[model samples]
Target chain A: MKLAEAVAALSLEVEDPQILDREVEGGYCSDLLSDVMAKAAGGSIWVTNQVHANVVAVASLIDAAAVIIAGGMQPEEETVKKAQDVGIPLLSTSLSAFDVVGRLYELGLRGTLRDG
Target chain B: MPDVKDVGALMSVTYDVAARDFVRAGEAASKLKRLLQQLGLDPAVIRRAAIAAYEAEMNIVIHSYGGQIKVDITPESIEMICEDSGPGIPDIEKALQEGYSTATEEIREMGFGAGMGLPNIQRSADQFRIESTVGEGTCLQVTILHEAGE
Candidate 1:
């Protein structure tokens, strides 16, 4: 699925649409940066509760398809800027992390594993 | 395809990492990823190096005072050296263990300090080494080699 397609279908707030057409291959929900780095497969839609700029950094390093800040959390201005600067798709939702992941799964995005 | 010739000509690159600066933590690692991408390195190898480099960069940002990440790239391999100036790890044995971190509450709240950083880096690199002085600092060397088959 493409990020923009999912965002429009689910009504997710597109915080930054720098890479809306980017491919969304998988999904992973975790707030732990190391865990995300170690296990989240490339091009996954990373669902996290972190609202800091570092979230953008992690997403970029792992080449995530998009970052969904769940639980109604809004990232700081710097985070949105960083995401835009790096051409990463940043999204937001009022749903909890679990709910967000479930909806993404419903949209046919499965979680892929990367061996740590 | 990008100029593989440029990647072959590459020797070493380095970047400064600021301590406790979560905002800019993954800058060096991301740049390294771009360089590898430009070289058209193996996707699997590039991902491994990127993840490892990110974890190493985060360690210096979360634990040490400040540091530098130096990377050397070739068609066959990538070597990264992360050296930091801070209160070094008192026990390498314990620090290498998963789920054993000394990060403050603030860091934990930001979704770090999981004690998985070092372990993750070790897992991603084909060869990993660590050296630290109690009061001086810590240094990590990580190398990821690419296979011909990809």
Candidate 2:
């Protein structure tokens, strides 16, 4: 799925459109940056509630397709700016992490996500 | 000439462990990923290498006094070596248990060093080998097979 399509489907508000063209090949939802860094496949969408800047580092290191901050959470300016600079799309949604994962599953976009 | 097909490409990197520096820890793995990309490795193989490398790197920072990680990349497989000289595990058997963790609260705040680290490393690698001495250090070698189509 294209980044724009993922944003639209998840009802997420993207602060930048330039980074929205990247494709979403998979999805990984986790609050722990280590887990995400170690497990998130490249081009996968990362859904997390943590607003820490380290999240951006993890996304970059793993080459995540984009970042989806759930539960109406907003990241710091540095976080948003870094994402912009790195061409990593940053998104926010009012849905909980579980909710976003469920929706992504419904969209038939699941790929290698750990089962609960 | 090293047979590129049968002999894995040798790559080694040594990081100076600043003992309490968790902030800069995963940097080596990121660089390794970039190198792997430049080599035009398969995405699936790269992902496995990245996971094993990152996990091993994190363990060095969180558990070891200081150490280094070396990676051997091959068209057919990838091998990772992580060696650390910290407070060596007295009980290797128990330490390998899934829920066994010696990580402190500070490490937990950084979201790592979980008792699951070893298990996670094992799970991520297709083959895993670990060696440790009670008062010495620990050495871990992990291998992941690459599917030709991937």
Candidate 3:
């Protein structure tokens, strides 16, 4: 699935629409940056409740497709700026992480497993 | 053939890290990763190196008073010497254990302080060594080979 499609389907608030042409090959939901680094695969969309700038760092490091900050929590100014600068779409929605994940699953996005 | 006098360092850089500077916390690691990519290192190796380096950077940002991480990259390996001055770890053994962190509620709320930083670095490095002295400082020396057998 394309990140734009997912964003549209979920009505996600994109921090900037200039960088949503990525493919959503998989997804990983975690607030812990370490966990995300260890497991999230490249091209996977990261779902998290964290709005810290570190979220942007982890997402870009793993080459995540995009970051969907769940539960409507807007990210810090620096995070949004870094996301734009790094070309990772910083998105948010009123839905919780669980809710967003479920919606993404229904949209044909799958979670990435370590062994897979 | 004669011995090459200076073939050890392909590139080297040192980044200063400030304590509790969450706004710019990950920039050092990001710069290091970008350098590796520019060198055209294997993507997998770059990811591992970036992860370890980022975790180490975060440790200093969240825990230490201030520190510096020096990166050394060669043809075959990447070496990071991360050092922080003062308020060192009391128990290296306990600090290395997963699920044991001294972070405050604020740090935990930032999605770090999970007690997995060192272990995560260990998982990403080919060689990892950490030492610290109370009231002195902490020192971490990590090396990740370019051609990891992953």
Best by DockQ: 1
- Among incorrect, acceptable, medium and high, the docking class of model 1 is medium
Looking at model 2, the pairs that clash are: none
lDDT of 2 by residue, A58-82 (tens): 7877888888999988887877876
Query: How does chain B of model 2 score on TM-score?
Result: 0.83
Per-candidate TM-score against the hidden true structure: 0.92, 0.76, 0.94
lDDT of each: 0.87, 0.74, 0.88
| Model 3 pairs whose backbones collide | none
What candidate 3 gets wrong by more than 4 Å, as runs, is A114-116, B1-9
lDDT of 1: 0.87
Residue A53 in model 3: shift from native, Å?
Answer: 1.8
Give candidate 1's error at residue B47 in angstroms.
1.1
Clashes of each: 0, 0, 0
Among all candidates shown, the one with the greatest lDDT: 3
* lDDT (Cα, tens digit) per residue for candidate 2, span B115-137: 66677677777889999876678
Compose the digit string of candidate 1's lDDT tens values, residues A58-91. 8888889999999999989999999999988889
